[model samples]
Target: MKNACYCVTEHRAPLQRIIQDTPELTGDQVLLRVTASGVCHSDLHFWEGRYDIGDGQDMSLSDRGVTLPLTMGHEIAGEVVALGPDASGIDIGAPYLVYPWLGCGDCAVCDRDEENLCPNQARSLGIFTPGGYAEYVVVPRAKYCLPLGDLDPARAAPLACSGVTTYSALGKFRDAIRTDPVVIMGAGGLGHMALRMVRALSGKGAVFVDLDPAKRQAVLDAGALAAIDGAAPDAADQIRAATGGGARLVLDLVGAESTITLGLAAGLKGVRVVVVGMFGGQIKLPTVYFPMRAMTLEGSYVGNLKELRALLDLVRSGALDIAPVTRRPLHDANAALMDLRDGKVVGRVVLTPDPA
Candidate 1:
């Protein structure tokens, strides 16, 4: 079989189409007929070739070992087409969400089921290797494949990245989430999914913050406690008033200068702030604030394989509500990415090989 891929031949350039013959799989590998793939904001950074790292500095993907002609879709769902001789416990023709955060299996982190935290080699699909911006994908191992069951492939695709990322971050402070309403920044894809996740997993609710009135309204419609405009002069004041003093936990999904500043300002004493977005920018805070307010700041990357399975279980049980998803054909990936980068997408956009 020849696989047709939309590859990043050059940074900031449209993905060029390439067809290559699918070769025989090595032991433990499996061939997947790509069913659905999500267009994520991180793809924008990969396409642009660098992530802004505050001031005038940037981190280049090329310097980090990412090469051109890359197929960059990590949030993927596909049907198993074939398996290697040693690949076990997977059924052919069954749809599953592929866990893309891979590492060398011998690492300590990988041994602990925390491959996403692997400090050594990161063979993460779509980033470091071939991904699902095509009709087919090659998963290095069956362990990376989780059964989608009755979940819609298009809707389930984002679960591999956005869903699991938010879920893992929320799980970190589930106690605080259960006791008090958390402040959620940004009402885009991650924020929307987090709203549903908080509802399903915690007793308390979330007060969402976004600059866009439409996004604020969307979260409000999704049963958020309150949706505040981040651009409002009284935004931090509004958040403080809404949370009664201040929020105990803040999920900074925007992860930029403004959102970080707002989270810090709106936080109560001993507040835990988790930054999950890749919208890179730096912030400055007085050193005294850390000790005086006892605030905690943490950065969360995409989740691990165990978290992915747990999230999928919640999704399969109907406990978790699926976020609104915009479906586009696989061939329209470039346009879909441009739309996402331009803030034109209301919710997550999933690319399906067959858009019928």
Candidate 2:
């Protein structure tokens, strides 16, 4: 079989169509026939080639070892079409979600199954390696393929990224989430998924912060106790009011300057703040505030395999309402990306493979 991949040949330019003969896989690999891939916000940064790091500075993906001609879709769901000689466990033709945040398997973090936090090397699909924006993908190992069971491929695809990312972040402050409504920043895909996971795991809800009136309304409709305009000057006050004095836990799904400041401001003393978004922008930290407030600030990358399993269990149980999804054809990848970049997408947008 030949692989037809949409390659990012240049920054901000449409992806170049590249066709290549599918090569024989190594002993540990599994070949997946791409079923659906979710367009993620981080793809914008990759497409643009750099991330804003505040005060006129930007970080280049190339500097970080990402090359051109890359296929960039990490949130993937597919069917196992082939497997390597040594690969085992996963059945061919069974649907599965690909876990993209990979690390060198021998690392201490990877040994603990928190490969997403691996600092030495990142072999994450669609970022450091070729990903799912194509007809097929060769997952490095069968272990990365989590079975979808009864879940729809379009919905399950996002669980690989948005679902697991938010789920891991919430697990960090599960105690606080169980006691009080955590304050969540942003109501986009991550925020929406976070809301559903919060209700599922903690039996509580959240107060959403977003500048978009429509997003705020959508989160409210999704069962957020309250929604505050992030652009409002009194946004922190509003969050504090909604959470009673101050929120015990704050999940900043938009990790830009404005949301970071607002999330921190809306927290009580001893509050734990988890920043999970890659929206990218530096923040000015108050040195004294850490001690004065006894704050805990943690950065959560996308989740690990074990967490993905737990999340899948939750999703498969049908207890939580999955985030609303908009389906688009695979060839419309650029248009779907543009919509996400323009903040026009209310929920997640998944691209289904073209008819065979």
lDDT tens digits by residue: candidate 1, 282-323: 888899988899998888889989999999889878899776
Error of 2 at 339 (Å): 3.5
Checking candidate 2 for backbone clashes, the offending pairs are: none
lDDT of each: 0.89, 0.87
lDDT of 2: 0.87
Candidate 2: residue 297 lDDT (0-100): 89
Instruction: In model 2, state the lDDT of residue 164.
Output: 86
Each prediction's TM-score versus the true structure: 0.95, 0.94
Per-residue lDDT tens digits of candidate 2, residues 1-356?
Answer: 99888879998998777887766988879999999999988898899999877778888999988888899999999999889999999999999999999988678998888888888888899998899888899998888999888789997888888888888999999676788888998887678778878888864679998988998999899789999998888988999999988988989888888888888888889988899877767788979999999999899988899999998998778776676688998888888898888879867899898766
Residue 58 local lDDT, model 2 = 87
